[model samples]
Target: MNDDTGGGPARGVSGGSWERATLEKLVFATLKEQRSVRRWRMFSRLLWLAVLGAIAWYFLQQQTLGAVQSTPHTAVIEIRGEIASGASASADSIVSSLKTAFEDRGAQAVVLLIDSPGGSPVQAGIINDEITRLKGLHKKKVYAVVEETCASAAYYIAAAADEIYVDKASLVGSIGVLMDGFGFTGLMEKLGIERRLMTAGENKAMLDPFSPQNPEQSAYIQNMLGEIHGQFIEVVKRGRGARLKETPDMFSGLVWSGPRAVELGLADGLGSLDTVARDVVKAEDIVDYTQRENLGSRLARQFGASVGEGFFLAAKASGVQLK
Candidate 1:
């Protein structure tokens, strides 16, 4: 029995040391956690600031780039996409740009820089009428300079111009109207699917793809298309006048080479935007006068439109669409 009571003091000191080590580990872990939280918070704030800065820069850039100057130039309005109501080449956008270009005293001539396969006839008609009206009011010559393809409604718009120019390789005409869709009645029968369509009006579901075709409705649609076609032909005739060489196949929804188009009087000559500006208009400087929706605005509009479209599609029956 070598005095066990003396070891009690040593045990107490060892226990105290163990307690101190445990407390130190806890404090270090707590500080590390706090540091990690601070780093994450800082990173989040930096990311938020970067986003704000980017948005600010985009707006500033748009403001700077969209500014119009009172300098002499050939004001060019680009019709480079579909001519639908919401498209860049829509009557609204093109007409607005044309108005600006024509109103600008510095603009020597208003040039329509067209590169499109065409779209809505209604949209084209609006643009055409506006072009004619603006030309008469402003006393400024409107010229159509084709790049890739200017057909159908695009040609309709070009017809309003004083002169139509094209590159040798460019496709220049497709003077026609069309309504296209699919008939799914046979497919539905094969799949044993019943189409239960209800409408308040008799002709409400007249062109429904899921339903059987009505002969009267078909004839009506054909007559409607023929009338529209006649209107298109008359417009072409009025615009081209003695320049057009009358041919059966000319207005048969057929596209022609730029040289052929020029020969047929669909186009005045083979010339580029540069040539038209420098040689024809006598203004070398070119300024873009096309009013365009900015990226952010377009994105927002498209998103909203897509959401609305889903509901519209669900509620409506499939039908014919014009191109």
Candidate 2:
């Protein structure tokens, strides 16, 4: 009976020990898992902090670069690509760059390094007006040195320059305006697809590609374009003064070689950015004051666009209605 009692006590002690060991193991395992999770969370936080620090550093660097005041130099503002609103070569950006360059005491003269086919006339006009105003305000000379092609709206802005220099082979001129669109009414007819477009105003659907062209609307548009072309001609005449050699085809939307342009008085001389800076401006050191889209701004724009697209898709999926 004593042996049986001792065995029962021993068995109870063994079972209790096994249970305690299992409980301890489970606690350690849970602790290990928690530690791993905590470590990952900490790493993610640090990574985010590092990214933020890098972005801050980039912005600070850009500001520092912009704020740096140099010795006497030829300040250059590039009017490249299409000169339209929201573009890098937009009037707002060019005007802002011009203001900075003209305001700088170290800048002797401002140079416009132009290379563009052209874009919005309104944008070009705004830039041209601002250049003239800034020149008068600062008593500084603005030179336009054309590279490759400077036509239409590009030439409109260049007209405001004190002098226009171009390469011998560069294409210049094309001082005209145009409205372009694709007509799909015939295509729709061939496919037996009918357009059921409704508009409150008759002219609201005036230039709709899917609909038939209206003679009255076409005439009105032509007249408007002609008026704008006249305005462009006036601006060029005012800027170029007597230097412009008038021709019937000068404002007929035709491009000319650089030498031909100089001969016709569209360009003053044949020169490049380097030559203009070194010889004409007399300030060999050229400093670019062009306002470009920074990396941070680009990233933000892309992120915003992505978010907008996501919302649009979600709304479409949910069948959201808008009036």
lDDT of each: 0.86, 0.89
The residue ranges of model 1 lying beyond 4 angstroms of the native Cα positions read 1-67, 295-323
Off by over 4 Å in 2: 1-36, 48-52, 55-63, 294-323
TM-score per candidate, in order? 0.73, 0.80
lDDT of 1 by residue, 1-323 (tens): 35678888889999999999999999999999997786666556555545555665696477435536577789898998899988778888888888878888889999999999999999999999998899889899999999999999999999998899999999988999999988999999999999998899999998899999999999999999999999999888988899999789998999999999999999999999999999999999998888766665554454555544443443342343423
Q: Over all chains combined, what TM-score does candidate 2 have?
A: 0.80
CA error at residue 249 for candidate 2, angstroms: 2.3
Checking candidate 2 for backbone clashes, the offending pairs are none
Worst 10 residues of 1 by lDDT: 314-323
Best by TM-score: 2
In model 1, the Cα lDDT at residue 119 comes to 96
